[model samples]
Target: MLVPRQVDPPETPAKTRVLFTLVFLGSGGIERSVCNVLAGLNPGRFATKMFFHHRPHPKSQQDRIPQHTEVVWGTDAFVYHRKMLPRFFWRLIQEARQADVIVAGQEGRAALLACLAGKLLGKPVVGMIHFDWGAFSREQPRRQLWGLRLLYPRMRRIVACGHDSAKAFQALVPVRPEQLEVIPNFVDGDKVRVAGEAPLPDWAVPIYQKPVVIAVGRLENQKAFDVLIRSHSLLRASGLDHHLLILGEGSLQAELEALVKSLGVESSVFMPGFTPNPHALMRRAAAFALSSRFEGLPMVLLEALALGCPVVSTDCPSGPAELLEHGRHGVMVPMEDPKALADALGRIMDDEAYRQDLSQRAHRRSEELSADRALRAWESLLSTV
Candidate 1:
């Protein structure tokens, strides 16, 4: 059965309709943050809806949509498939007709689609860039970049998930500086705090007996789980004797498992794909590590800080440095350096005094990304469009 939403607001001039467009909602940071924003927005002034270009997977992470927010699904074909683009475009245009503003839930094809729909329908569009666009361009197709250059400028505003992300996008893309806005990812502090205290899952019980380090992110190349695994092996070789528990599923699962076995850290390393609630694990772990090479402001980092989990992350482009306040809040290590990663994780795991201090500071820093502050920033941005 489809999820039900509240009926559309009575036809009135005061109601500002906002439609969110995306390829699909999967077990990723972007989908989770979008769902959080959808649930947190005030309904009194905005009529909200989410349109998906494909069906959500049964195994994917699910979030609660706003009570009355209508959910629409379009063609199920791959987003980049030529046949799917026109159908997705048509669906977006149809949805755009009823919306005052179109919030493109992600960059790439979805942004391109929303930009096309908004242009043809004379509706304002807002594009959300969730990754480090500068680093992303290296792997993006020339044609897609060309399309982005043409379509992005047409957006009323482009929302970057980090301050650095905004600067990176302006430097990497053709969008004007005036069209960009930096809105860091927001965290549900209360929910994380409660969930962190919840009982640990059965599989994680063994981790409690020994020191445990947890890493959570999609098993993609961008996340660089290979680096994390190597670092974990180094820590084990040095007799750190801690367990590494990685959460989330992606295309690299098999490769990562193979690497773990080859490194002889299979017993110490665990890749439990896509845990529904990782907060409890975060709270119980010795430290939380984010080994991404680039990010637009990782929500997982903030979620860990909210739970008072001492974090050891790569000083990667865009988010980590800013989130860690250049090493004030948490330990920041060089990207792709297994030795440096091992040292940082070792520090957090071996030094109880240092770890507790970092945790206390991190918890305090969590206030900066609290839901109330981010919600107001988003509301202010939405109201003007």
Candidate 2:
């Protein structure tokens, strides 16, 4: 059964429509990201709707979204594999005949579907890209040829989440660098800050009275929480009094738990699974840590800074290095270096002067990504198109 949307019904006053189509919502970074975008968008300027391929349907994260937007459920999670591919295209044509814009991420089933739907409806579409599809796709050539070659040039604009992502988008299309828009993820700074300041809940493990380090991301291989765990074990072995808290879940949970035991750092490491309010935890923690193998302006990095948490992130390509301003604002250890990460963690935990300096710089850096500022950037892009 599909989830019910409490919509106010279709009310296109000037027969104009704005739709943002996506694959799904919930359980992962991408889904949470789409929610943040949807949250920042003003409803008056854009009548937004999210079309999902698959969610935890009937009881999905979509259910929790404010009633201002409509969430439409699509039948196929996979573009070519879904039985209703042709029919899905047909219905998209039928529904989007008058839509002014269709927002889609580049090189996913959603993007392909949006491209097809736009062509059928004679509607202009915009591709929103974070990372290149080839980085994660099995049928790279098909997506590149059919999705990129055929679909990209036809779209009105391409939006990238960060500078690195914009570069990735450039590779997909022959469009000039000036044609792409690089809008960093926006943060509702005041709200996130307020939430972060609140005291921790009673259920949270109380290991970090003084030396607390926190990293937030799913336990997926891509997030490389395993690498962080291994690094944390090294930190503990070096006589550091710090405890590491990792928030979020994935299939690697059991493997990570086992590794913590084998490494004998169970007393100093805690995995409390997923928490919707990660900022709350981030605020109380002494510093924020990210160990992702790569990212498209990782939202957790921004959220941590906005909450006034000093950050130490892996200097992975894409976001953190840029966000840290080449090591001025936050510490950036080379990716997958246990000793380097341990050293960085130790500095943040043991050295107050350096940590406070980084914390101040982080706050200043976060101001660049204010939600209001980003909303204006979006407004500018929307006007240009």
Candidate 3:
């Protein structure tokens, strides 16, 4: 049995059973957060059901949903309802009422379904806000349609990942300020290995004595690797010979590769693809870099800092500023500006003393966001619901 503590510290409750349901767990920031929550939740008090979406039969997401979590296949994320709404509801109606509360970290169509099912079964539904509520505000017509179809106002609460996200969500729902809670993404920093000099690869240690400029993210549009490639090109032209090694893979491979070739910096850029132990990589990296167009609080940046990796990231609207505490912990360059990005990267790479200072501050700041602390926050929220 999986159980999570139901009461806040200093107070004890007799008993409470809560079910945390994730309606979508596709590989992304939200998926990562849900995974963290599942892995971090106290198994003695709460049970988790992580639902996945892509052609759900013989589902693979179940394999990753953490052993403590009860992975449910053909669940809401699959939209099995589109094919058999009444029959699907017949099955889910029972599952919805099996706990004191149903936590849905859902977005898009799945959210509407979770809200409806939770309401019909008289279960408290806490809708988790992940990405921008919509392209603009929470009141996007899609939500209005969901409200009309599901009468979504019946759901109990809306949990947001940031202040801006909370505001966007309330713009659509008539939620009180107290009801929209802002909790940022976090990692178990204690588990993070402090970045000490690793035995550098035989070739890299001597040939390129400068700290390796490292960036990690999928090769996707939102990640903006092209911008990083362009910024790196500028950095190289300015005589900063440090090699750029990006870790992760995506469809943008051809375009990004051509950009590297066009910029004539193929020799300086390396893609080692997806790395399972990014924390280990961060430990030995000269610095961590992010050049994203937008983000919902990046997990990799948080992990990098915990590993003592000095960071230089584009000042994307909400995520970086919140994570770096307005550049107190790391360098934040203006978005989409290559010169600004290059200058920041150059400063961090060339100014050894400054980079060291930032690295220490980052590691110290990340220490507070340990898995235990994050779990306690989740515990507090679930207790109230």
Candidate 4:
């Protein structure tokens, strides 16, 4: 008897291999956005790998990276020196060879390295702009600006986290309009809500006992935590009784602490650096405040809206006004204006009906900027690239 003829199995289409490169894996909005993209992407359609120029610090959110994606750490230095860049580029080329698409997870050195690798390998490179580009350009060195001018135009796409960021990039860089894409940062609303429901730590229990105005961000100059501290003092002076809680860690911690002390609001202000679950604090806080001098699309502000926490943010460049819909969903005050910030915070903390109205609008706005919508946009971009 003859055996049945053997039949071959149908071939499965290979997933698009995406290589994401970042300067480091620190606790910043860019890092968080990378982690979210890695986890949220459809695994069947895209395979993700990350290359970090420097090893993550102890406080880096490395644990949030998905298990399926491969992560490569290159160096330990906070910033790569010119002498070390040759080696970094060689390693990145090796990584880029295996990827179909290269993503510069952030601007600056990461974008430079990724662009170099993409050019060498003839791969499409997608660069990300995560800050107000005009402000960023002013702060960066001439060499950095030169690098952007020379390399960013070579990218297949330049993604700005907000429309204002896109406009800023167009003004600063001579990239074609078609090359720019404005895909605002987004968070997993369900996960954020779940995290928000977590029980507060023992030490933080008393801080939340009094109605608190919460702000979550690095203690860096851009975040303008000093402005928030000053506003807290103003609110106190005006007879609004509310504690101020600023979360996250950075170089300006000491300076900000000194500011709090100098203003004599240390008793009412708390700086608990780098907690994993700031959503919990935001969930219970009377108001969530953002006093950033500038931002691309603040992840913390989105997280606050996701939790339906009342928001009062500085009408800073790019993100907050857009996220808050020009004061439709939340209050927007002038940047670094302590009195305006203080008044907004007081309004939220004082008027229960108005706070509730903002809370309702916040939840609705979050749905429009949900993780699923962002993931779909990313998938479309990756597929085409």
Best by TM-score: 4
What lDDT does each candidate get? 0.86, 0.73, 0.69, 0.88
Better of 1 and 4 by lDDT: 4
**Which lDDT tens digits does candidate 2 get at residues 62-88?**
544547767666564533356766765
What are the RMSD figures for all models against the true structure? 6.6, 7.9, 7.0, 2.0
> What's the C-alpha lDDT at position 9 in model 3?
70
TM-score of each: 0.93, 0.85, 0.79, 0.94
Q: List residue ranges in candidate 2 displaced over 4 A.
A: 1-16, 55-66, 75-81, 84-91, 105-107, 132-150, 176-179
List candidate 1 segments past 4 Å from native.
1-13, 76-82
Compared with the true structure, what per-residue lDDT tens digits does model 4 show for residues 118-162? Answer: 888899999988899777777668888888889999999988888
Per-residue error (Å), model 1, residue 313: 0.9
Best lDDT among the predictions, by candidate number: 4
Candidate 1: residue 110 lDDT (0-100) = 80
Clashes of each: 1, 0, 7, 0
Better by lDDT, candidate 3 or 2: 2
Clashing pairs in 2: none
| Candidate 3 CA-lDDT value | 0.69
Q: In model 4, what lDDT does residue 131 have? A: 90
From the highest lDDT down, the ranking of the candidates is 4, 1, 2, 3
Minimum summed lDDT over a 10-residue window in model 2 is located at: 132-141
